[model samples]
Target: MRLESVVPLIPAELVAALDHSCGIRTDTDLLFFGSSLDIIKKLPLGTVTLSDLEKFTELVAEQASVPGHRGDEILAGSRRISEKHSQASCGVKELDDLVGGFGDSRVFEISGAKGSGKTALALQIVIQGLLADADSCALWIDTSGDFSAEKTAQLVRHFDLAVSDKLLERLQVSLGFNIEAVHDVLDALRNSLSSSRTVGPAVQWIVIDSITPLLLPSLSAVSSQGHAMMTTFMRRLRELAQTFGITIMVINGTSAAAPFNQSSAFASTNRKPALGPSFTFMTDCTLWLSKTKDMPDSEGPFSVHVAEVFRSRATRSRIWCTFQIRHGVLSSTIPDL
Candidate 1:
């Protein structure tokens, strides 16, 4: 049946004629009260009721579809713009040099032993993106509950951001203790990005404080079901990153055994890939942060070796760069090498 026949079936309250006096396209499908075209097209001809229309409108409004844009094409265009932006920006020189700036639909895994400044780097990205005036927002998925409001405030104060209040409001931190909670938060975040214009740009970065927590439990479980669950979760994360043009940075904790060398620091050891090669393979870039004991005592000062991009697969794999966190700002010593 034609939409015209269905028009009479629609309640008088829900059906309103378009004001074509303004010269807008009236020949198209009828616009619902909620302004969703999807509902108009999907509404059945004879049996559809006002309540059905309302429900359809609500469903579409809640989970709107992403505009169809080619991911590779978008990334290519964004790369040129990001390179220019990175050249002007400070602190991110080493990182920008390596990857030419983080690309949309990319998953970067930062893995190393604990206290490797993974969280610090993630925070830096949030601030730098804001500084670049990209109208971007970050989603901090804190699995470890280690994200500090105080730290964020310090960074805000250090930068003296003119839009401190606005930027702070834009950066959303969701604390999820369990895997289920994490999944739920991720879903809610995606839905918010799809539905709310007020949330600014679709979440530019999704930083999961640690992906290992979810992985380790799944890997250790007694049944094959556990492995399936793990695979499903990782696939979902990849899908989310690709669908929304968002960059996902997941911090992973490395085992005591060295990732590359099998030789144990102690006597007896069972060596394996620090974190499974599966994670390394899944990620677009695998960065390692480690202290450089080789630096002279006078040059390095304390043993705190700052942040280092140890392993980046994009441009060069075995490049090492040093960085310092001063006044809550990450300053890299290495130039674009």
Candidate 2:
């Protein structure tokens, strides 16, 4: 059957041309709706009639085959996405190679025991991100009040000195000790994104220095409200990440004991992220940072930390990368001993 022959068989009154202006072009878009009510809502009220609804099913059955974009378009798009992911960096070359860089619009958690260098890793990532591009901005949410001006300066000094101050200016810090305060910070950020008069560049990353503080107090045995509150907070975090296309890094802690009736958050390890299972569910990637005692994990004077991909949608198997801090600079590969 000729493509043109099938087209004239359908009445023009029954179905108008599926154009971009109408927000539908193919069967896929039309099939996305559950019923005619949704399609009716898309049009001006009363333009579509009961008669149209009557023939809607028949309209679908005899629908003309509309040509979508070329099939090669999907492969091209996938390649572009692959290239973008390749371009994204975690500020550490070795770590980026291991689990792939922190790509767009996702939540990544850095979890470890107390002395395992979680904050250092996150700080390095944000500072590097800031230094890489002048237009790039970031937000540091200080839950435990660990964010320090002097410390951040010390970290960025390892990169470029000429533009360090200018880049540092792009980073904003807010002390959000409680859940409500964090929500308020996000609300303010959402508003800033909406307002045209906003002077500052839109942020690329949001780093939460130790999510444990903001959440631990609420996970109580006496009340389910705590968990409910936690759920709401996590959902909001997810929404902000998706809506604003920001990469979120949350610092978390590990607990010796697992939650009741559930395996460890990362099945390969016994120690679990302290915020409970729901936190893990919300996270797109879990980059587990830990201080290793093994000889292979270290070289000389620097304290070598092992970074493992506990959970990542992009990776299939467990992958680990080693990093160390030398002269206040964090590097995935230790410099010549």
Candidate 3:
């Protein structure tokens, strides 16, 4: 409270003297910070009686505020938990444990050389997620137009027709040859999901298999527009994911040389992830997949594969797990200690 606010309680003769000469304008100023004796000394010795100062002090003391909590104390009281409330497995237990599993409202990137099984890994996770939660569905965006239905069916061939058919039915696949194509697909998909009367299971996951083609053409040494477009594209994807609680996974194939974004293409052998370092922080986590040595005591088709956590906010970077693809299924393998 200001000195004027307590005017009725304060003596009329003392108002101007205490307010101006004392410099105690606010209720806080009138508190003990400025000693009562100091205030009395500042006032006219004859005009203000000690009894009058005591009365004024009592009135202002009623309006003084208590101290508040410090920033560190408040932060300590509200410490955060990093674990996600809901997690969708990657179908391999060891692999799932390696990177904290896929969770809602986060973007994940899988980058690797061609034939390293990036697409296969993404598809398996989606299928497993759908099976794990019956109410969940997924959107598969095939950017290169070569997404194989036959291969996808092969993985679910062992299951009964009813289960397999329904899972595949719930999965909606679309071709997106360019950035515009994928953006349109995502926009329409988001709109359809917003309706309360949606036709089927709610979409809970999205896989953009190989984002190279969609973004490669827009990049060059002199142009920054491509990067801007990429940022916007990712922003929209994140918005959709957060709004609907969808988990987004993007496949980023590698390039042979550091500056060979144009030379590199999806489904081809390359040395590094295409596009450039811009992808380092675009996603919540980055998993690098690559084919390793063949499994011993088995047929040649099943080779040991490695999935490394190149970057993550929830898991330690550079940590990796090994698995094998046997009979169209992913199985976790423990390496000798």
The number of the candidate with the highest lDDT is: 3
* 162: Cα error in model 2, Å: 0.9
- Residues 53-157, candidate 3: write the lDDT tens digits: 887788766544333568996454323212322557876888888778777457888898877778878888888888777888889999878888887887866
Query: What clash count does candidate 3 reach?
Result: 0
Per-candidate Cα lDDT values, in order, are 0.59, 0.68, 0.73
- lDDT (Cα, tens digit) per residue for candidate 1, span 1-337: 1122223444333433222212111112222223444444444444345567566344433333234668898678557544534422335676666654665456787766655567777787777676665567778988887889887977876776576777787688998877767877876776686775644455777888888786677564355544545555666677677666677888888775543433223223332224455556667777666544432344343333333343454566555556655444666653431
Per-model TM-score versus the true fold: 0.64, 0.68, 0.69
TM-score of 3: 0.69
lDDT of 2 by residue, 1-337 (tens): 1112124444444346333224443333444434666666566566556466546545553553333567697467545545533456757788877666766567888888876788887777777767665677999999987678987887776677787788788889999987667767887888797788987578878998878888788688886656755665666677677666677899898886533213323354557678776677778788777766423434345667777776776674367777876555677654563
Winner of 2 and 3 under lDDT: 3
Which regions of candidate 1 are displaced past 4 Å?
A: 1-90, 196-201, 221-223, 258-275, 293-313, 334-337
TM-score of 2: 0.68
Give me the overall lDDT of model 3: 0.73
